[model samples]
Target: MQTEKIVNHIVSWLNNYATNAKVNGFVVGISGGIDSAVTSTLCAKTGLDVLCVEMPIHQAESHVSRGQEHIQFLKETYPNVRATIANLTPVFEAFKKEVLMEGKQDIVDMVLANTRARLRMTTLYYYAGLEKLLVAGTGNKVEDFGVGFYTKYGDGGVDLSPIADLMKSEVYALGEYLNVAKSIMKAAPSDGLFGDTRSDEDQIGASYPELEWAMMMNDAGKQETDFEGRNQEVFKIFKRFNNANKHKMNPIPICEIPNKFK
Candidate 1:
């Protein structure tokens, strides 16, 4: 994938985009995940004002530690990089108190999990507005386009996505090239929205490599009838997610007014 060339390209793209937008820099939410680590590093490479924000809400210890480690690494390695901890736990708790919790347990949990992501999104934009920085997205191809694994108007809301074109494996390669912390690079891929140890594989019922393969097959016009056994299972999983989350992938729909009526 020409890791070195891709890194340079993304860095240059980021710098040019910020300059054209007249923004001082970027603000990225650090989640202690591979995508975020690689993304923040790319922003730092641009030598612009990169602010890495840690907004944890009942986050697991491992996630918190990895986030801190990466933020520290960025600060030590790049003079333009700075970090802050928003610690949105209290805000989250207060919000829960004010909202209705009446629903099926699983549904309620799902809503709250998405709430965590939205809260973090708000935090990132707040910093972006205050610092005149764009909100840099940390999504990759699989999550952003293939499975729609992120929260809409939450993690999905961003001013720019530097790595959205790269697949998960490619993002890992970039992480290795960027010298992201070993802890983060080795940790299981997770959205960290549930505040638990369940990995993305657990939530999606398919590992990234499996999903990547499924995405490719789908792109090539393959169908479920063409696969057998486990392959069929994976394909079904991928298709289910892709179909269910089409809303996240497609542009928001608008009701067009008739010109004659206007």
Candidate 2:
């Protein structure tokens, strides 16, 4: 891809979209990940008000540091960029106390992890509403479309997605072009939802590159029978996630009423 042209295109698109919507700018949740770093930078390039929010809930130290470093970098580099820390740890703890935790340990943990994402989503939207800003999404092609590696109505809830078309590798290229903080660009991709150091690869059982390849193969009408060994394993993993999380990818189903009944 022509990196400069792509960057300009996204920046222009963001500017036009905000202007058309009559919003001041965008609010992005910075998670110390590659996607958010690249996304927030793009928003800043539009020369509009960009608010980078850090909403950590039992977040790992590395994630917090990287998020702070990126936020600082944005503030120093872009006059339109500003940042705030919501620190949702206490809110999360309070939520846990009020909810029922009676389920299989793994299932309960999964629900709570998703809750963390939802809480962050709420925080970003709160700021967006208060400031007349759109909630900018930080999802990429693989996570948003291929594997559905996001929480529905959580991180998946957004007013605009600037980098959803770009692959993970392409996002990294944009990060390098945008001069994103080195610490963030080098850190392994993570959701930071679990409050631990496990990388996205650990949770997905396949790296972005592997998932990208699998997505391409699936798009090209390839099947599991066509692959052998590790390739087959990766394909299966991709298929499992893609099939399981189709709900996130598809629009919410609405029951249609028969015209005669009306």
Candidate 3:
């Protein structure tokens, strides 16, 4: 689709979904990443009331600053965009202290990181309920489906996912077309769940482009060598992450029993 069409389509989708669902507006967690920036911008374009909340849990100052900057842009450019900052560091610290055990730093770290996502999820819903809004998710195709790189019931719990079909590159293109801040478009993507700053590539084992390529190959029923005709490392990492996180991607399975109605 053309850039203008893509923007119009997404904006229409947002508006139509809200209208059909009988919701008042959208609730988006602005994480200062390109995905959130693009998603929030699209939400703002719908001309519905949008609450962009920046929930930081001991995240980098750069992350918070960028979030605030994007919120400012939204407010200035769109009349319906509203934003606020929610500090979640103390809440995370309390959970850490309550759950920490002896000789389990690694386990605690992983659990705590996921807790950050869930905390933000809870916070978003809290505001959504107050305003009769839907939680608009920020995940793109590769992370949300190909690698399942989202915390279940955390960032994964949302009323709508407008960009779940777009690849990371597609998202970047949309971000640029939407006139999102260049700093956000250029900055490394991160979840900001960990206290220490780590890009998404650092944690995901492969970059978004590589993951997207691997997904394309996988969907085409091609072997690892089929991806760019040589490099299988990317495909290998993609499979590892996808297989391990399949539970997040697939809907819960249910058993069936035979009936005698025939």
Candidate 4:
């Protein structure tokens, strides 16, 4: 889709949903990443009230600064956009030491990373509730469906997803059309959940374009023939991610009794 047309469509969709739901505006957590930057800009384009939240939890100074810079850009560019910083570092540390690490069961780094995500989630909801706005999610198609890289019920829980259908590259294209900050557009994609500043590809074992291609192949029910097959590594990585996270991609399962049992 043309970037401008999609941007307009998303803006209209946000306004329509807010009107139907009788909500005040949108609430987006800006994570200093292109996805969040694009999503927040989309919300701001609607000219409705938008809360661009920066919730940092033991984050790098550079990441936090980038988030603040993005917020400043939004406030300057859009009159209706508002921003606030919520530092969750102390809260996260307390919860980790006093609660999660207190048990005999050893918690993994993934557990701590997920806790950070959930903390940010709660912070977003807190402001959303105060303003009677909906939480706008920033996940794209590759992470939300293809890799399931987001934290379920953390980043995954949202009132609306404006960019979920777009692939990662498509998001960058829209970011350019939106004139998103060059720093953000050029920065490597990261969840910022991990304490270190590793890029998403470092953790995912493949770039988003590769992952997107794998998802496309999986959807088409095609597989490798042999050494002649294309992107076998990509297909393998995609399947590994999809299989591990398939439960998150689907709705919660429940017991279904048979007619005879009933």
Candidate 5:
């Protein structure tokens, strides 16, 4: 689809949902990453208030700072949008100490990471509820309804998603249409919980472009897409992240009862 049509479709679709939900607007986080950048822009353009927040942790040097620039752009471009920076280091530090003392942190890094995500989500919802707005999720098509790339109750939860069907590459294209700042459009994406820490690609072996391709190609409809043999790597990520982040996405495991309890 043409960029204009696609953008319009997204705007119209989201507005439909927002109107149905009776939200004041959308509350989004600007993480100095392309996904959130695109999401925030789209939400603001939809003629809804976009409450953009920058919740960075101790690792604020890399992408967090850049996200602020995008927020400024959003504020100027969309009068309905505004931003705030809420440092989450204090809470993360306290929680980190507790986790360290538990001695089970190694087995639960997933939990800790999701805790950060949930913290951001909590803040988003706090303002969203107060302002009667929907929380605009930042996950892209590559990660949409994905097996696992988000925290269950954390960043994954939202009242609406504007970029759920656009691939990372497509998001970049849209960024150009929206004239997103060069810095933000190209900045690396991170959860910001790890200072100069490894990103999703570094933590795993795959890159976002390839991963997005992998995800898009995986669909049976794209049978002719020819992803060119990244299946193993993609599956590996699928397996590893799914295994590690399972707790964040699934219900509590319960032993199967084969008619044992009457």
Candidate 6:
């Protein structure tokens, strides 16, 4: 579909879903990144009430400034838009105390990263439930259905990703089509876990676009994808993340009863 039509289609789909759901509004987390910018804008187009949240916890000044830029853009563009600021530092510390009690202090960075995500999720769901809104996700196709490049119970546990079918490149293109800010369109994608210029590439070792390209080749190019050459460096990264996070992409295990006994 054309970019305009695609944007309209997404907005329409969400609006219809919300109307049928009889919800109060739509809630989304804006991380000063492209995905959330595109999502909140799309939701605004449908005349639906949009809540854009900026969750910056102990971030540097630049982080706060960038998030404000996104918020400013959205406000200038939409009347029904409101960007809410929710800090998660205290919550992080409280939980850290509980973890120290357990004696497993290793992997603090990784654990804290995931903790931030889950905490954000809890806050979002609370607002979602109170407002009866659908929690719109910012995940792209590469991350959602492929390598699952998101925190499992945190960012990964979203209600719906409007851009789930679009690739990273396509997401930028649509952002342009929607007149999103240039800085936002060009900003590096991140989960803002550590505020250390982290990205999917830094965490997963391979960029999202490369992973999707690999998947495309595997689907269409047949056995050649298994052949040597193409960014072999990324192959290992993609496979490793996929394997390690299988549980996140799977259903809860229920042992099958082979016998018919009650």
> Using Cα atoms with residue i matched to residue i, what is each candidate's TM-score against the true structure?
0.99, 0.99, 0.94, 0.94, 0.83, 0.90
How many pairs of residues in model 3 come into backbone collision?
A: 0
Candidate 6 lDDT over 99-168, as tens digits, reads 7544365476777878888888888888788777888988887777678778888988788778999988
Q: Which stretches of candidate 3 lie over 4 Å from their true place?
A: 225-230, 255-262
Clashing pairs in 6: none
- The per-candidate count of clashes, in order, stands at 0, 0, 0, 0, 2, 0
For candidate 5, write residues 1-262 as lDDT tens digits. 4998888888888788889987778888777888888888888888887789888866567586688788888888889998888888898888878755454765466567778888889988988888898998988765654446776778887887788777778898998998988987666656654566467676557777767655555554443233345665675565555457657456779988788685
Per-residue C-alpha lDDT of model 1 across residues 164-195, encoded as one tens digit per residue: 99999999999999999999989999999888
Per-residue lDDT tens digits for candidate 3, residues 1-262, read 5988999999999999999999888999998899999999999999999999999898898888889889999999999999888889898888878874666887767777888999999999999999999999999999998999899999999999999999999999999899999889989999888876699899877888888988998998987666553358889889889899999988888766568653
Which has the higher TM-score value, candidate number 2 or candidate number 6?
Answer: 2
lDDT of candidate 5 vs native? 0.76
Which stretches in model 1 have alpha-carbon errors above 4 Å? none
Error (Å) of candidate 3 at residue 45 is: 0.5
lDDT of 6 at 3: 89
How far residue 210's Cα lies from its native spot in candidate 2, in Å, is 0.2
**Model 4 steric clash pairs:** none
lDDT of each: 0.96, 0.96, 0.90, 0.89, 0.76, 0.78
Q: Could you give candidate 4's per-residue lDDT for residues 18-103 as a string of tens digits?
A: 99999999999998899999999999998889999888888977788788888998899999999888989999988877764543
Clashing pairs in 1: none
Model 2: per-residue Cα lDDT at residue 75: 94
**Better candidate number, 4 or 6, judged by TM-score:** 4
Any runs in candidate 4 off by more than 4 Å, and if so which? Answer: 100-107, 226-230, 257-262
Summing lDDT over every window of 10 consecutive residues in candidate 6, give the lowest-scoring window: 218-227
